[model samples]
Target chain A: MDNMEDNIKCVTCTAPVNIAVIKYWGKRDEELVLPVNSSVSVTLDQAQLRAKTTVMASPSFPNDRMWLNGKEQSMDSKRIQNLLNEIKQWRKEKHNGDTCTDGLLMWKVHICSENNFPTAAGLASSAAGYACLAYSLAKLYNVEGDLSAIARRGSGSACRSMYGGFVEWDMGSQEDGSDSVSRQIASENHWPELRVLLLVVSDQQKSMGSTEGMQATLKTSQLMDRRIQCVPESVEKIKEAILKKDFKTFAEITMKDSNQFHAVCLDSCPPIFYLTDVSKQIIQLVHAFNSSCGITKVAYTFDAGPNACLYLLEEDVGRVLSLICHFFPPDKDDLNTFVQGLQTPSISPLKVLLWT
Target chain B: MDNMEDNIKCVTCTAPVNIAVIKYWGKRDEELVLPVNSSVSVTLDQAQLRAKTTVMASPSFPNDRMWLNGKEQSMDSKRIQNLLNEIKQWRKEKHNGDTCTDGLLMWKVHICSENNFPTAAGLASSAAGYACLAYSLAKLYNVEGDLSAIARRGSGSACRSMYGGFVEWDMGSQEDGSDSVSRQIASENHWPELRVLLLVVSDQQKSMGSTEGMQATLKTSQLMDRRIQCVPESVEKIKEAILKKDFKTFAEITMKDSNQFHAVCLDSCPPIFYLTDVSKQIIQLVHAFNSSCGITKVAYTFDAGPNACLYLLEEDVGRVLSLICHFFPPDKDDLNTFVQGLQTPSISPLKVLLWT
Candidate 1:
């Protein structure tokens, strides 16, 4: 047998970020991390926006240690503690009377995580980071029951990042929140023609975190309470729109829900304003662009920050992209690098040439 | 006797502008110009923002002729027609059994109107214009049942401008809207210490007029439906706050209602954005200023335009003014002209010197 230090068992995993089509704004239970309404999201390609995590366990380690990016973080965060405790309990139950393979369950764990995209740019970096951590640690400790539910313990939205394509998180009714989980609505290949474009309006960290912001909304906004009441029906409609692969209904629902989320934000006491001037201009531009086409060819959704995530069909992507560049021209040197992510390198400049 | 043309009957009146603290957004009856919810407003002094109207009826005039400011305008506008028709009908009833002083009531009317402030700047120039028109026309025709009711037919908000100081426009339950009218809540001297500061963020015409904007909101925003349902209760609280001279409660209600108005704008389909970067900066500045003081000494509200109207006490005016000038310094040449309206010419630079 190898030494305990030499027996450093490790597992690595990568998870993609997700953008909500129907947003989750308020929560019913802060302790259980239960949402007031269900939400739907699309997982970006891991190659474009992803978080990579590695977990190593060894008997020689004194305690659990975690590093985000290159810097070490405190293991005392309650969210991290919840995820760890839940996973350990699952492991104990899975092998109640059976022999374990590597004795990794009892070993102290060390976790490291990093994201390719800008963190806290309203790109859901936390979701990907927490999802990757849960995936990697579960693989390392051989804990396998309801991974999404375990990820939800870390970040409410993290559960949705566990799957690709369209996914919806049901804001479960159970008092224990045992039923609150993310389920895949469609596979990545279900709508191959669809494309997403993120406009990084700003890289600044948000003044208010989503958790604190939602708490304020839940407490103060009467409109938020009303919004939550209508969301259950909206969730069903959105699911149907996704299954039908109907872009019009999907785009309308996505844009309307985004607007309503921001509306509730504004209604929140001491109101949270997430959309900046650039964000408003983008919204107007999209409306104008759709009006010109006489159909909804594109849709935009903003999270808790100013960045705009636009969705469009593959055929219309070039046209809308060209229009965006024209309306919001980048600085001379920044033109070439104006856009980033999966479509940038693959789509030829020739495609935009015709649009210009 | 004078020549027939010299026998022209004329009357002129000036009306003060009104700023809605509890905004009236949607119209229940477009033809009647009836609001879906009640609203309250503070009537500004005519020395600052006012509309002056002169109506002359002469048998020599072939048809109704109208002039806005100095330019001749078509008399075909339905809003203008509504005001004229209502005033004339009132005249016929008042003198049906008595001999009229002159046959001026049978003559075609020639009207001239002008506003001290910029029209379509969300300063409610139309409210003042219609109020002045209704007032002047009533004086000429010697007809009086309810001038505000006739003004409401011209512009829904104009009804609020008919009264001085604090005014409330009741969204009457009557089907004919005969009961819908403006009533004075308090006299102009009720709170003499209260002062208003208008920051002219922009004088540009709004992309969507309030009428069209509200139509969109009523048609599309479900949040707006819920908002209207709560307005009757809000109106009562606002009335109580005003009567009690409770600045804290008054300011909180004003700020929250303003934010809710804009929130519904965002919830509208294809969303209407009325606030600009400057408007947002002003909001944040006001919040920061209030937070520093540990009390709500000042309150800011925005209409459809980007301009911000701040309310504060006379004692706190100088310090707040200095702070505003510091954060939003005008060009050196514009410093003298920074503050507009009634307070501009009367208040010397010496007043601001006390704080600076």
Candidate 2:
């Protein structure tokens, strides 16, 4: 109970979740979002693309109000509503200030959310948005549990979003999922020089959503068992590769995992076709470009859609970026703006200007 | 020792090779056509579909002549021709006959070859044709060296065609390719009741040739190395699965290997795009159909193109055929004699009765 106008404060927080080259496939418990094995992912920077969430609570308001990506949504959904109720209950029990009236039964909450990038794209905007919403609410409500544990409820991959760096979600054996949580493997500060070049190929929504596709794969794919068993080993290798900054090992592991994930997609009962011609072309061109330049290890990963996210070493960033730009040359009208936007203080100003 | 007509007879033979569920990706040596690891394959029945070759020689003819398919060809362009010459020379020397001076050298050989099925439609027609051609020639010329060894020089897979059943190509480490030969894993008589349904999704030639694609993959894909290294283990598993007649293990290994092969195709520098929507649909339908029926396994393999070759358990053969026919209904209007001519005997009798 609360007269929340005086006690509650609206706070906005945002974050971005990364894709796992070593994908998470089977679940130990579907309801709990507990995976069959541990999985690792790299957290992307939140400067240009992220999920923005604003959480507001007040006694003056009538009921919980929610907006997801600018559209009004029902708080009636069991999952979202349950989380909201839990947070409200926590806030009421914790607050002892006079700002909370003794007779107050509820505090109305309004949450607004949006993403800087397209939600329809296979770029996993929902993963980032849901993870951000959970993290932001946890901070606003002063929730006590571990961030990863709370985020896990939001989405399976959301657990990895709690940390702002490389993270690993360990699919623990506890039946209650109490031990299934993410741990920070490496921080962004540790890899400050690393850069990711995102090639936004298609912004259209995927035909089969990840959850549905994964469920289908578990049911139909004969290969799913092997893949599930293989993930733990892949996770370990990826962790070691990232820690050592071994781009060769990292690239190899990442590419193999991505292919394996897509293989599982193909292995799904009534196989899910995700990668389109454009997606395939991007893969082809990336390899060709890398080989042509004698670059042994630049990593490219694709999600459920056609977009490509290329990870490049700091020293080779400029050359790789230039080659990418030249190969995937933007529309004449957008070229100048595209080139200018990629400019950073540390990059050669002359080179950036030359592109323009 | 001077009479040549008694020593040589005109004979032609043809065979079809099966694509492995576990693919052979890289070569140990291009010159020797030696694979980095052992590979397993199924041999399609000759009566249903195979390569057709005709070999003819006469004293009236001039020079040893060779024709491939329908066109006149030069022996110089083909490596197999040189190998044939070596065999002929050996036969002459072994017999201690002046057959070369008895107008036998003046007698020419005319050879014509054709495939009942689509060429390069993921069917391994070339392997069969070359193998049969070489085998038939060995018989015609009475070449003395091992037939398997001679077939190996024609095509890496041709050696498998020398036998009439399941064969495994031993990827020996010997640089001379002396030990790299094929051996029968199982005879057709061992699984006499088993049947294979070949779904000709498209008869069109593949856009990307396997040889060119393999070369590209070897030059660029990082996954190629891993694939080559990993195939030996899969081969062992597949062999054991086959020997045990374990359909579940067999199907699982086959599907996983096919997916991995295509994954390598995607991982290639230029990316080899082989499957079509129809091919993907077939894969999906097979998965869904099998899963819905609670059948854990049914094997399907694709080669360089979209056509699907499904290996059904003898018990499920009728059900699968009916299902496939129902889903991919044949166009009655487009049913010409050529299409009608190729129908399986089991289906042909029913079609004839229905038409009458």
- For every model in order, the TM-score on chain A comes to 0.92, 0.86
- Give model 2's TM-score versus the native structure: 0.69
> lDDT tens digits, residues A96-180, model 1?
6345443777789898998876574456688998898888878876767678888988999999999999999998889989999
Model 1 RMSD in Å is: 3.9
- TM-score, per-candidate, Cα-based: 0.93, 0.69
Provide DockQ values for all models, in the order shown. Answer: 0.78, 0.17
**Candidate 1 wrong stretches, greater than 4 Å:** A1-5, A96-106, A120-122, A343-356, B1-5, B97-102, B118-122, B341-356
Clashes of each: 0, 2
In the range B163-193, model 2's lDDT, one tens digit per residue, is 7667888888787888888888888777665
Docking quality tier of candidate 2? incorrect
Please give the C-alpha DockQ score of model 2.
Answer: 0.17
